[model samples]
Target: MQVEIGSNFWTYSLCEGRERKLWWESEEYSKIFLKSGRNAFKAICNYISADKRKVLFPAYHCGTESEPWYESDWEVEYYPIENNFTVDANKLKQCIIKAKPAVLVIQSYYGFDALNDECNALLQECRNKGIIIIEDITQSILSDIRHQAVDYYIASLRKFFAIPDGGVLISRQPIAIRKIAQGDNNIPLNAMQAYSLKREYFETKNKGIKEEFRAAYVVLNELISVNDNNYAMSDVSLKIWNSFDFTYIAQKRRENYRTLSEGLAKIDYLAITRTFDNDTTVPLFLPVLVKNNTLRQELQAFLAEKDIYCPIIWKKSPRIVDCPKETSAIYERILCFPIDQRYDKEDMLRIFNTVEKWNV
Candidate 1:
């Protein structure tokens, strides 16, 4: 059995052979596929032609999600997000009143509820003021608590699935933008190479294949960074995305998250970021807020040594808006455990056992 966890996807061979209906097809929203979520956000900016339109984004973000706004010359402001990973509704309301932004971008971190009761009320307040709400569902793609107040929904699919390149823009109203030219093939080509090499590494347990896989993965990321050309989702990726069984995928993620949560509770060195809500959330990852910054680094290295890799949710991105101390502290201490469809209870237990060893 493959022991590696949390990294670029290995080659995907499983396909649900029957004709399948995509989840988004049931929704009324007109959808457009893009090369990346950054490009999707850029499409929205291109659609909204206005003079000096202001936008409000959460302070705690991956940085790329909010870049299109700054690039489009929109006046940007940040609202506070509590350390508990919920929006500070009162402060956000105050920001909305003060800034009167033309657009508001909010995210439900790690597949948690995008808005609680109070935040929902704040969303209504924004709607009343004619603020265009953009919900970044990149972290919460499977989440059920989709707020209807949102004017645009955007997400990067690369985080969840094995797709080489994909991002989607969804809106209830018709979305019109200039035709996107076909993207360069290097990004997807390198991505497929990395996945194939990773699969071979697992089968043969070859150290060289693993190193080559990492190198290819690095090159893939670098290619994306330099190439910001807006492009439509490739037919190859679209077909792969359609073949998957999302129902089973979502169920597996929830189960794995519960198992990890139960196991992590007994460890004092780290704590799960928030309680899992079984009803609404299909968790993207089981995020843990490690107590000590130094311990967090140690834990990540320890896991990597055992072929279990946990990703830091966001590094200190230079583009991150200035947030309060609480948000900053959360960023410094946060780490994401793998709880995706690729693993079952045995894999989750493997992670717990390895972590228990390091807890000593």
Candidate 2:
């Protein structure tokens, strides 16, 4: 197996000479009707007339998914969460009633829990108030949490799968739309390269080789960074992404996350995310809050030296907003460890051992 470190240390075997297959076969991949000028998020925005009058009430703690969508015409407001990252349901309700936002965004952090009844009730209330709810399922996938409740649901498929770039936006109400012609002619080479490398890595797994695969991954990430143009979905890449058995991947991820949580539970300084009430999530990564900022950075650096890639998933504040003091404080202490299907028990042990050694 090959090993490397960055946002998270990942290990994989190679799949150099294998039969080609679709990523998902039995189940239909979520259909995305793509228009030339608009992406999934833009489509959702158009549905809500967000460009005309956009207002987002994002929960304080989340990744960059909610920040980039804010436009000049749109006013973004952050609602505070308690020490545990759970929003105050009453406060959320009160804020929505008062602000009358155009859209309310909710992120299922770490995919460990679903929206609690209180949160759902608040979402329902917002719906009744004619406010749209956009669920960010970037981190949550398998719990079968119905998206029917929300006006629009979105997820960045890359975070969950091995594919390089894909964002899914599903809406219940069909708005006037247009599909981009297949030969629109502006495919980003860099993005396509990343997607290609990711495919290579996935295919090569289990070939009893790892070093070349790791090198390819590094190159792929570099390409992704340099490519500024948005990567539009290609027919081939979409087919590959949809071919993988999602059920197997999700089950493996869930089991791996549970193993990591149990193995590292004794680390007092690390505060892992607990399952939220009512919601069931497919855990993406095992996020921990270190005792202090120094420890967080030190551990990160130490892990990097060992080629153990741990990624800090999101920036603290992408823009100027009066974020809660608690959220800001926790952001400084948080780090995410790999707990996806790509890892196993030995991988978990290695991570735990590394952390324990550093604790000395």
Best-fitting candidate, scored by TM-score: 1
Worst 10 residues of 2 by lDDT: 5-14
Scored against the true structure, residue 184 in model 1 reaches a CA lDDT of 53
Residue-wise C-alpha lDDT for candidate 1, range 203-250, written one tens digit per residue = 888887878999998997776655356788766677666777777778
lDDT of 1: 0.81
Clashing residue pairs for model 1? none
TM-score to true structure, per model: 0.93, 0.78
Model 2 misses residue 7 by how many Å? 5.0
Which stretches of candidate 2 lie above 4 Å from their native place?
5-30, 33-38, 50-52, 61-64, 178-232, 275-280
Predicted candidate 2 versus true structure: per-residue lDDT over 1-360, tens digit per residue: 235422322322233322433222114334453321125555555456643365555545443454346532466676665545566777777767677677787766677544568887777877876777887666665555554458776766666655543556665554454543342222234345444554455466443334554565566555433322334555443554546665666676676677777867888888876743442456777788788888888888898887677777555666745667767765777788887777667777788788877753
Model 1: CA > 4 A from native? 13-23
